[model samples]
Target: MRTVAGTGVAAVVFAGTLVTGSCQASEATGFGRLHPEADFLGSSVPVSERAGAVGRRTASVSAVAPDGLPGLDVSHYQKTVDWPGVAARGAKFAYMKATESTTYLDPTFATNYAGSANAGLVRGAYHFGLPDQASGAAQAEFFVANGGGWVNDGKTLPPVLDIEYNPYSTADWAGWCYNRTPAEVTAWLTDFVTTVDDRTGRWPVIYTTRGWWNHCTGGDVTVPAHSPLWISPVASDAGGPPGMPAGWSAYTFYQWAKSGTFPGDQDVFAGTAADLAAFAAGPAS
Candidate 1:
């Protein structure tokens, strides 16, 4: 596959290291603690929503997953995808990257969004959260206007906030966000979430890693109870917490493999396929 680009520098290309529940920070793995820590506590989502088990098997859709419904998160990096081929493989849903910061929109978002749905898969749009670029609310408005809005249709997954590592230029490992305070991060998240929820009837899904969440929001950034958690944790828990972060008690989505054959990042939806369908229906009222 050819590289399509556009995930931004520190946003998707430089994925740092996946942080799970264990919060592993090892020099050997290049896990660096860039976020300042004072004190904060957290878990993930709600206890009842959590799968409460390690899932994800490196196999095809027919193969047993660690648990929950199966899906993928794709961006322009995937080039042109065969949405029908992916759906035929049993992917129940998919998330397409729509925008990053205020100026860059994923070039493949429009095609992927319509294609995935036409192929019979639940589809959602995600924004790569860039705290240093602009206010969260401003970014949210920009994102929504650019296709991040959601209607409670049973087939449309709510919008997602992809908040992870800081801006690190892929060419030289040069980073952007330098002195971002934890409080500032938390405020940014709150603004983004509230703005999105107010515009749409549903809260946006939060995609983050344990380390990024903790560092950016000072451990447990408080969002609406309805906002969902989508955590990315690497092998062996990455020496970080496993199940989730602090503010949440569980997770709604888990991105398990970045190199999985599923196209992009392979994920588990935290429940059965039926339950996942209902989740696609929209958040709890």
Candidate 2:
């Protein structure tokens, strides 16, 4: 069963933190309130107002997302077909692969970023953080130097910081990190957010897997103000309330499936169409 949804940006350079220094995940961990008191209100954009509107059309049968905020995720450049065609497939926005760590970036980043624009889809980029470079300053400098162009306009969604642990990469990249514990990872991530925010004038979005959230962000981690969350869950149970972010109170994006015939991706984010709009609004920029 593949759960699905939509995802964004373009230029990016990822760095490995666990290998950069001794940052522990535990040292940076802090806690705050979780869950929003608000309800999941419906979208202000009516189904009849969608772009492909020709005749009387209801959301259930409409190709455009009911909320008029369809989206997609592009991890590979070659995999992208006609950017316009994919966008017409009801995709209003997208997330593109940027960097993976301090030393590497996704090979397909540039093309996908441009493709999303050509397709008329609002796009954003993300980076896979290296646990080794815990110094917020170092990580920020690396990220800005590498992917700053993606945020030139400050119109797209905030760049996403993808954090995950690769056991195979532990010895060389993950083990040497300063304060490598979950708390430390949280602190480093905070630093990354701060640095990126200062440089780009945009708060960042956080993307992580279920296991990482459980182990890295507990009641201890303090997510920046107005920070949105992009969460990936391997199972449907991950949809429960507890799956939401602690400080933010709710997740703006949720990756439900990793494999499927998604409009433009090998993976998809699953959430109400309104979530798409929120992503489009970007990081309070």
lDDT of 1 by residue, 146-250 (tens): 778887677789999877655332211123222467777788888999899888777899887655565456776467366889876634453333557667888
* RMSD after Cα superposition, model 1: 11.1
lDDT of 2 by residue, 1-285 (tens): 111112232222123222111122222222111111110011111122223222211122212222224455655533545677776666666776555444334445666777777767667877656555436556566656545333445336667776654321332223323236767767777788888878877777777544445445554446635467775433323224325545556556654333233443332334544665455555345
Q: Give me the candidate number with maximum TM-score.
A: 1
Q: What is the lDDT of residue 208 in candidate 2?
A: 58
lDDT of 2: 0.49
lDDT of each: 0.65, 0.49
lDDT for 74 (candidate 1): 84
**Model 2 weakest lDDT span, ten residues long:** 36-45
